[model samples]
Target: MEEKKAAALSAEETSAAPSLNNNTAIISSDEETQGWSTQATKRLLWRLDWHIIPFMSLIYLLCFLDRTNIGNARLDNLEQDLGLKGVQYNDCLAVLFPFYIAAEIPSNMMMKRVRPSVWLTFIMVCWSAAMIGQGFVRNYTQLMVTRALLGVFEGGLFPGVNYYITQWYCRHECGFRMALFFSAATLAGAFGGILARGIAEMSGVGGMAAWQWIFVLEGLLSILVSFTAYWFIFDYPGTARFLTEPERSEVQRRLKEDHGHLSNDFDLKYVFQAIKDWKIYIHMLICMAGFCPIYSFSLFLPTIIKNMGYTANNAQLMSVPPYVCACFFTIAASWFADRARQRAVFMLGFQLVGIAGFSMLVATANPSVQYAGTVLAAIGIYPQIPLGLAWNSGNIGGSLKRGTGIAMQVMGGNCGGIIASYVYLSRDGPRFITGHSILIGFVGMAFFLTSFMTIWCRRENARRDALTGSSGPQELTEEQKALERELADDVPWFRFTV
Candidate 1:
């Protein structure tokens, strides 16, 4: 009697299956079936980290150093040499982001078509050449041209890499990986100052100023690294050469199980779909709020320290400690965030910490206290970046939607860079009270937006759970499941990570 009922049920499921493909067999085997062990997973991740993280991090470090070294160059008379007056220096800083913003989405789309290694390396090379050209620029217009070109080339890297990393790691595992990759910028902050200080001694070499040497050296380093990246950087899982067939299959299976299904097919409609999703805008707002402070401080830290009465060399050295602190704190926070599997909670907590740091800056007169506040601000801001990025990337499923969503979020957020350039005016030096106050308000807004997102995601997850009758993937007929997989995160089986 039980056998008969089971047969009937199977027949009914087959009959009701949606017309997709005829392969209706369910894969009920566990990880053991694919020879996936804890040790194997560890070894695979280690291999990925070895190959992927360091290369990506190195690229970002160079990208950041080349982009922001102008702030260091300012101390070496770059502005005077270029005959920049009034808000011209600020305008140069501001101009980068408009082109940067405009290029990001299109660049990401191109990256998907051209492949990551080729696209990423191509951009790196272009930006490096632009960076080198800055050293030869004799006038403000020439400098602006180089800066604009640099922006266009560099804009795609961060979001493109962010999306690429998500393709390899599970949702829960991405936070720390992102932290490891992003910590390069903080490390760059620490090392770039020391590097800039040392390079300043090359003044009058090759008939160029110290600032010129700074750009030349860093740009050369970027170009060298780009050559290496061209040879070393792997494409997506399907094309990766290092993985065995079994290992590759296991990775694909595991990713699908960890998140929902993904599609590689390019569809412009995904961009519209992502745009209509209100959650994407919420995350973008949080990112924008966060970036305002991060870019403002990173681009101006040396100058800020100099304003505190340190010499240029001493100010460079002083800037190192805060970034060093931020590097360690960012890694630790990401590890904890990944372990706890709680992005929004951690993001809110860190944002509040940053707000406190800004408050200290605004409320204090003592240079020592303000410097301490800088450390706190670095600690708070750097960690939340990876958390927020991973949070949005992990929650958005499907390759096309994730790509477009990440690009949109990054593009929207980078508008803050423009705002940051203008807010920290030359006249606002010594205290920069207006800048600090504005940063505090942005951080506050970030906190509120993050809190709201947390609540909304939780509610959405609960609603999905109620509909599915379980908190996990629902059992559906094989054909129905096949159809659902193509729907990406829109499928009821998919749950948003809060």
Candidate 2:
């Protein structure tokens, strides 16, 4: 009699399951009562934001400062001290990206095997050590070795953080969270200049140059932060000790409702699926186009400002405002993008703005006009980064697929960093017309690509919406329901966010 009753209840639930066209409620009343309320989710998100976002942001801050401080060091006579000639300084910058690109996919895969806290903290420590080694390097060979190590260690961070953040938030919530994370780079830019200027004053201390002092101090700070991060960074919802059992269940339930499934299993099939998906390649293109200007600006802004006829000190100080502007603009844009639930539109709009800024830089000879262009360029380009990332994360459903897709996107995009390092040649000097032109062309390409992807997603969502009958979730057997739960965004009921 008990077995018969169980079978009857299972049959009833299967019959009541939601179809693609049906308004049948999918969430259980027990779940609704337990913790799916707006207030509960809001409280959970706030807790996550407080605990997660700030620490992740700080890690990236250190990452960017350590990686790009070479640009600052260049201004402080690193080139002269190391006897770097012609493109050697550029070579130092470019060499890092190859290692950086090579490490991203594998590191993300490793992060899946190891916990994020363990993996990220370990990388942070390694990169910090590399940064410290950079300070002690006496020649080009030593500098290149340190740069390569820095790249390999630091490569895991952005993709790792991106994948980790997606686990905590629903699709709509990710834009702002990602913005908060990506904003750290701009914050690094803003403070890095001021910090570099101050460190430059420490020249001759302990028989070190200003550039050496910059690396040592910043690397030490990173090392200190890594110890704290090991304790603070939370694992996924199911395993995180900070949350109560009910909270974990609620978190999982909410994500499952938002998009079917929340598979944490590491499947090779999903990785292959991600690689085969044409959308990943398109996203890769967008990532590459958008990042070119951003990386270039981060590395060369001080030099660019200095070329405008200011003293090196003034240039360092001046570089702060544009990044500060970018930081605020990114937050605002991300907030709007989340509220609108529109990704591609925001990305295209901002890319156009960046193109305009680049146009100004290319066309104008006036120092003030060029500086204003820099402000516009930073404001425009940086905001799109988080939007693009969130867009890709939201669209990709399965855990392994999402991780692999994001890693691929990041890996391909970072290749642009290599391109950026070489574009602003010493010959371009004060008027980097060639570099600006290249940037303008890429940003324009991104704009058109974003439009295409947006249209593609919208059409795909429509087609999924129009499906009926057994093709929908309503007809799923009990075993298939279980499979669908693990399939995530690949489930027919899941709709791509456009």
Candidate 3:
């Protein structure tokens, strides 16, 4: 009887254990589900993946398209239209950068305080209007005005978008989304070139020049996109209304946890303090060095292809391949970056490739080889942008500080745009020997800086680890430690992945 009674009790205990575990699981899940209904979670994830991403990507696509359509216009007699000769075209290109650099910092600050959905959309609309106005330019003065207007509005786009992405996604999720948004630039290059070819073939559409069609169609499209952006795009997670109240709370909690409990506080003093930091200068140098070739390529790709003995249409179409390669590399690089949880190795590697490509271009004159260099250059140049943004932004501790830092980096980096415009003077157009050499040198410098920054970060992490006697190579205060845990749970929390 005792043996039989023991057997019966063991069976009951095994059966009851699962029931107890199930109840515990239910309670834990329920607690986490607080303020997050099933409906809300479903809607939020859906909107993020399906709607917001594509919408924003298209906006950036048009932005890049409008900015670069100038390349196509160059082939369509812009020089003749203005009666330009010997560096005037290049001078016009160079003029855009000063304004771009001057206005970039203020534009970012405005985005932070004025609300993104409103300001960003307004800027887009304004720039598109400027682009359309280009179609009406009968003299160099009118052209200059439109170009300046375009710069004034476009100055906000890239940096603003980078900041905007952070407000919605965690560090880990950021790479893919950043890649998607950044890839729009590549897509714009491809599509803009292709579109230019088709539109250029439509000579004298409504008695306007072929170049006018380029501006008119693209500008109108951009304006249309702005309306949609204004209607649908939210300022931040805190401002999104598409989600239920429960879902809204979940988003707020997630963002707070992921961001080290930092809130977005707009203070002019803090912005000034961020600007004063020396690291901001270093980042600026890195961006300027890295982006010189990119901006140069953006402006000169069609011209470069034309020199290879291709027809005007063929040259325009040829611009597509390099950018297509770049888009793939960008997405692949970002994926590997997020997966490996490292940024330095990929960044250094890509920049090194860019250096090599630009260096090779400087030595080669053969059409096929030069064409190959273009592919390598595009891939090398674009892959570094997102990695850089993530690496620096992730390290920042506060939203306000990060916004300021990003704004500064962007504003400072784009000095290259101005520099690049002047580098390849019209006299050196068909064979831009000096320009290629300078780009190679800058690319080499960028590689060195990225490598150096990576090593420094690793040493810092090691020192921190030793001080804390923690399991990892970095140490933090209790508050920082808790914040790290929260951030890590959302993402893998790998060290600066060099």
**Residue range 311-411, candidate 2, lDDT tens digits:** 99889999999999999989999999999888888888888889888899999889999999999999889998899998887777667778898999998
Residues 1-498, model 1: lDDT tens digits: 355334433322211101111112234445335566789899988877888899999999999888888888988899999899999998888889989988888887886666677789999999999999999999999999999999999999988888778767777788999999999989988988999899989999889999999999999999999988866877665445677767666766656555433455567877677888888888888888988888898888889889988999899889999999999989998899888888888888888889888888899889999999999999888887889988888777666777888888888778888988877888987899998999999899999999898998788777876776652323467775565646667766666777
lDDT of 3: 0.72
Estimate every model's Cα lDDT from 0 to 1: 0.81, 0.82, 0.72
TM-scores, all candidates, are: 0.92, 0.92, 0.85
Residue pairs in clash, model 3: 342-497, 343-497, 344-498, 345-498
Clashing pairs in 2: none
lDDT of 3 at 487: 36
**Per-residue lDDT over 293-369 for candidate 3, one digit per residue giving the tens place of the 0 to 100 score:** 77889889998889877888899999999999999999899988987878878988898788777776777788888
lDDT of 1: 0.81
Per-residue error for 218 in candidate 1, Å, reads: 0.3
- Candidate 1 regions exceeding 4 Å error are 1-32, 471-473, 482-486
Report the C-alpha displacement of residue 63, candidate 2, in angstroms.
0.7
Q: Candidates ranked by TM-score, best first?
A: 1, 2, 3
**TM-score of model 2 relative to the true fold?**
0.92
Which residue runs does candidate 3 get wrong by more than 4 Å?
1-47, 471-498
